[model samples]
Structure formats: C-alpha cells, structure tokens
Target: MGFILLALGLVLIAEGLVYALAPSLVEHLLEMLRALSEAQRRNAGLAALALGLILVWLAFRFGV
Candidate 1:
C-alpha cells in the first residue's frame, strides 16, 4: 500500500512537471493525440502499460 502511494505520488509529480514546464506543449500533444485513431491510442496506452510493468518488475527483481 505504501509503495502504491509512492508510485502514485511520483507519477503525479512527473505529470505536474510536464504541465508546469510546457503548458503549450501539453496542448499540442493533446491535439496530436486527438488526431490519432482510437486504436492507435489504445495501442499507445498498452505499450506504456507494458513498459511500466517491465520497469516495476526490474526494480523488484534487482532490489529497488
């Protein structure tokens, strides 16, 4: 549970930094994402999920 909270907080911090540093870039990214097909978006999200899972597995596998 603690690790989950830590992960969520880290994610939020990363998201906040992006928005804070490049608000306009975020808007442009949103526009680009909107132009993508739904299937493309789904695949992109799945890829992120898989990468995240791999990172987590590696972190635990080697000792965080």
Candidate 2:
C-alpha cells in the first residue's frame, strides 16, 4: 500500500541521514551490536519492533 511504501522510504531516509552525518557513530554502533549475544539482539529487535508499532498506531490514531 501507499502508506507502507512511504514508511519504508522514510526509514531509508532516516537511516541514510544517520550514516551520512555520523559514519563513525554508525560503525561503532554496529560493532557494539555485533558484540551482543543472540538473545540480547533478538530482545532489542523485539523492543524496537514494539516501539515502532506503538508509534505508528498512535500516529494513525491521532491523525498526525
């Protein structure tokens, strides 16, 4: 759907900006993530997924 495509594009733009503005920070973050255990990574990913869903839900709910 259009909304899904728009969301994907926005995510790409945000990710691009982070890499563009702070390449070293991004590399450091990646290194830290690589050092995390599988379970820790999975939990972190789940937390991010839940947070993103909540944000999107609120955005649509509030017509923001």
Candidate 3:
C-alpha cells in the first residue's frame, strides 16, 4: 500500500511538472495522441506498459 502511494505521488509530481513547465507542450502532445487511430493508441499504451513493467522489474532486481 505504501509503495502504491509512493508510485502515485511520483507520477503526479512528474505530471504536474510537465503541465507547470510547459502547458503548451502538453496540449500539443494530447493533440497528437488524438490524431492517432484507436489501434495506434492502444499499441502505444501497451508499449508504455511494457516499458514501465520492465523498469519496475529492473529496480526490484537491482534492489533499488
């Protein structure tokens, strides 16, 4: 439970920084995502998920 909260807080901090530092860039990114087809979006999401899982695995493996 604590780890979940930590991960959520870190994600929020990163997201907040992006919006705070470059609101326009975030809008542009969203627009590009909107332009993608549904299949493309799903693939992109899956890729991100895989990458995140790999990263988490690495962290655990290395005792980080």
Highest-lDDT candidate: 1
lDDT of 2 by residue, 1-64 (tens): 9998999999999999999999999999999999999999999999999999999999999996
lDDT per residue (tens digit) for residues 5-59 in model 1: 9999999999999999999999999999999999999999999999999999999
- Residue 4 lDDT, candidate 3, scale 0-100: 90
Residue 14 alpha-carbon offset, candidate 1, angstroms: 0.0
Off by over 4 Å in 2: none
Q: Rank the candidates by lDDT, best first.
A: 1, 2, 3
lDDT of 3 by residue, 12-60 (tens): 9999999999999999999999999999999999999999999989998
- The segments of candidate 3 whose C-alpha lies over 4 angstroms from its true place after superposition are none
Candidate 2 vs candidate 3: the lDDT winner is 2
Clashes of 1: 0
Write down the lDDT of every candidate, Cα atoms only: 0.99, 0.98, 0.96
lDDT of 1: 0.99
> How accurate locally is residue 37 in candidate 2, as Cα lDDT from 0 to 100?
100
Provide TM-scores for the models: 0.97, 0.95, 0.96
- All candidates: CA RMSD (Å): 0.5, 0.8, 0.6
